[model samples]
Target: MITGLRYLNHSDALFTGKVPHQLGSLTNLQYLDLSWHYNRPPYRNVDNIDWLSNLSSLQYLDMSGINLTKVDIFNAITKLSSLSVLHLSNCNLKSIPVVLPYVNLTYLSTIDISENDVSSMIPNWLLGMHNLVSYNGISTDISKLIRDLSGCARYSLQRLKFHNNLLHGKLPDGLAMFSNLTELHAYNNFLSGCIPESIGSLSSSLMYLYLANNRLEDPIPEAVGELSELVVLDLSFNPLGGLISNSHFAKMTKLEAIFLSSSSVTVNMSSDWTPHFQLKNIRMGSCVLGPEFPTWLKAQRNKCLMQAFQLLYLTGFGTYLLKLST
Candidate 1:
């Protein structure tokens, strides 16, 4: 008859043993977080979360850092019709549940199952979760995953992260469908090919974009300038080529940080071109930064002081760029 349990957060509590089955008695519980042991394996492992089904009113559940490799996690949680947010990140899961088409998780707003060992293609049922807003499924085949996401959850997906995965192939053109998308992080993957020009379609809502440490090649897309709301743009450590002049960043007036280090990009711009944006951090090491010191650095002195700068190759002229203001 216990109906008033509402919140429980035992994250990092260092408690050992299995999750108590008695918790299922708290039918009114709304939020429960038992995250533990991130650097190492969790001390506790649950064979089944079948007890969770009894908590019909559960809206938020986070079992991150717990071992659920042997459990059918999806089947257990799908029964919680009121669930709005679910976080099972860093769990030792081997695969995503095969969801049936008839099953509907329409109320789920966010799902983070990142850092797992999931090796299967994203289940089709996931796409039916039309209310999904944010998803982080890191360490998977990027191309197939993005393709599936673009096809299924394009309209409702806003924040997507699949960093440090086995992602390859060009950035999909279908990404342009996410008009409501605000942030995208696919860094540290094996993604290659040019940045798709279709990404400009998200200019109105997109803010943060990171695709660093990939095999992406070709010139920076001119459409990138259309992202007027961009705050941080990192395309560093890639084989990106072609001239990246002021025109490429003409409309990125809100840009705060730009990272393009260790790339084959050439920054060909006028020495006196005063940029509209004031940057806080700019890393363009091993890049071609012109025959003369970039005059835009002077304009950033008063409005935004350069916090960090690392220039590995400043053209063959061997002349140090403009002295940055403290």
Candidate 2:
């Protein structure tokens, strides 16, 4: 009969031992956070979380850093149809649940399962989450994960990060299907293939894009110029080649930082072409920027005013102002 409870957070407290099963009595609980701030000894881990199945009204649950290595986590949380946010990062989970399509997860929006032992291909049910907005699945095989995302809820997705994973194969053209996506972070993986031209489809909303340390090749797509809202872009340490001129950055008026180091690409902007945006940091190590110091940089001296420049082996590039004007 007790159904009025709402908030509960035991995070960072030095509480020890298994979570009490009696907590299931809070049938009306909406938010529950029993996450430990730091890792506890194996013997002190919560032996089970099956009690969570009884919290049918639960909307948010965070059990991060609480060792659930042996628990059947999916079975415990799948019934939480009201859940909107779930955080289980660093929980030592060995695998993600293979939820059936019949399961209800319509209201789920954010899911953070980073720093776990999830080695299998991402479950299919995850891609069908129509309301999903942000997803963080580091160190997993993300090749299939990206492909499946194109099936449904593509419009609701915003931030998608799968850094340091076993992701291989080309950056799928299907990624452009996510019109609402703002941040795309898939760095430090085995991903290969050229940056797809369809990426221009996200020109209206995308802001942060990080595809560094991969095996990507071919010329930078000229369609990138359509992304006028881009603030940060990193394509460094890949095998990308060909000339990247001012046309590629023509409409990126919001660009603040750029990294293009250790690649075969060349930045060949016209000497007098004035950039529309003001960049705070620019890294172009091992990149060919000049036969003559491009006069365009001189425009930055008066307008954008660089704060940090990491240029190596460039004959004409030199330091400028220490900070950008506000």
Candidate 3:
């Protein structure tokens, strides 16, 4: 008799059975996930809690792929004080569970417990979360997640995702006080430094900024071309070098996408740098695009209105392909 389960983790079954012994009458359950869908049915069920203390109107508590061990899931998620959103990505979580502020859920925002075996500090009681916008997975202290997101700047965050893991150092000095941060996904990790000339104070309705790969070297400054309503800018690979030009993004014109493959592998474009390499989703493969590369991809389809592209592996461009697909 599974009673009234509002939400049972591991994606609703596939190694799911326990925690169903009449689910303690559900008590008008709000949301309770036992966790497992590390991407669906990843299989993680050993001695289930069987009824989860008869959940008392749970808010949203994903057990986060429970392998248990961290004192048996933070002592049963601190007795679930109406949890809001807590998915500890991979189990094996090391720290950061200080009873989570007696979790009244208080309308919690988002918290993904990334990869696992967490470490690197960053549990300042989640800055007393006043409806946090995001507390992206795992630890590995990237300066304590920028000092708990610079005090979570009044928590009006728009978007934030800490991609990959192993976040090392650099790029976290108050992060412009989250002036209503739009999006900042710290890719890969092992973060070296650079790319923070106050990052232009971001938030011009900022749209996606990922520091790809890591070990960030020099060049990528120019205050990120003044982020004019920037839209998707991933600094590929790292080892940053010169000519990190943007010429002020040719007035940005609401740039769609632009990822400089090898920041500086040989790329020496100088036809007056041509209107600041106008973009509509470009990956700039191997740099050095001197030759008649379709006259610079038909001059980026003569400026805008281009649609969808990937343009992978460049270099003396062969096995050609550049179908702007209308």
RMSD of each: 3.5, 3.7, 15.4
lDDT by residue (10-92, candidate 3, tens digit) is: 44455653434455577667776767655555456435553555675677777667665424555555566677677767766
Model 3 spans with C-alpha error above 4 angstroms: 1-15, 21-33, 38-60, 63-81, 86-105, 111-132, 135-155, 158-178, 182-223, 227-232, 235-258, 261-286, 289-326
Superior candidate under TM-score, 2 versus 3: 2
CA lDDT, every model vs. true structure: 0.79, 0.79, 0.62
Q: Can you write out model 2's per-residue Cα lDDT over 1-326, one digit (the tens) per residue? A: 44577887777777777877788888889999888766445323667677888999999999888779767777677899999999988888888866663567789999998888876566777877888899887544455576677676588999998887767888888888888999999898888888999888899999999999999997899988888899999998999889998989888899888888788787889776899987777776777766655666655644443322333333455442332233
If candidate 3 were superposed on the true structure by all CA atoms, what would the RMSD be?
A: 15.4
List of clashing residue pairs for candidate 1: 142-167
Clashing pairs in 3: 9-34, 114-137, 267-288
Candidate 1 residue lDDT tens string, 266-311: 8777766788888888777767764545666646654343323333
Off by over 4 Å in 1: 1-3, 101-104, 138-143, 302-326
Candidates ranked by lDDT, best first? Answer: 2, 1, 3
Clash numbers, per candidate: 1, 0, 3
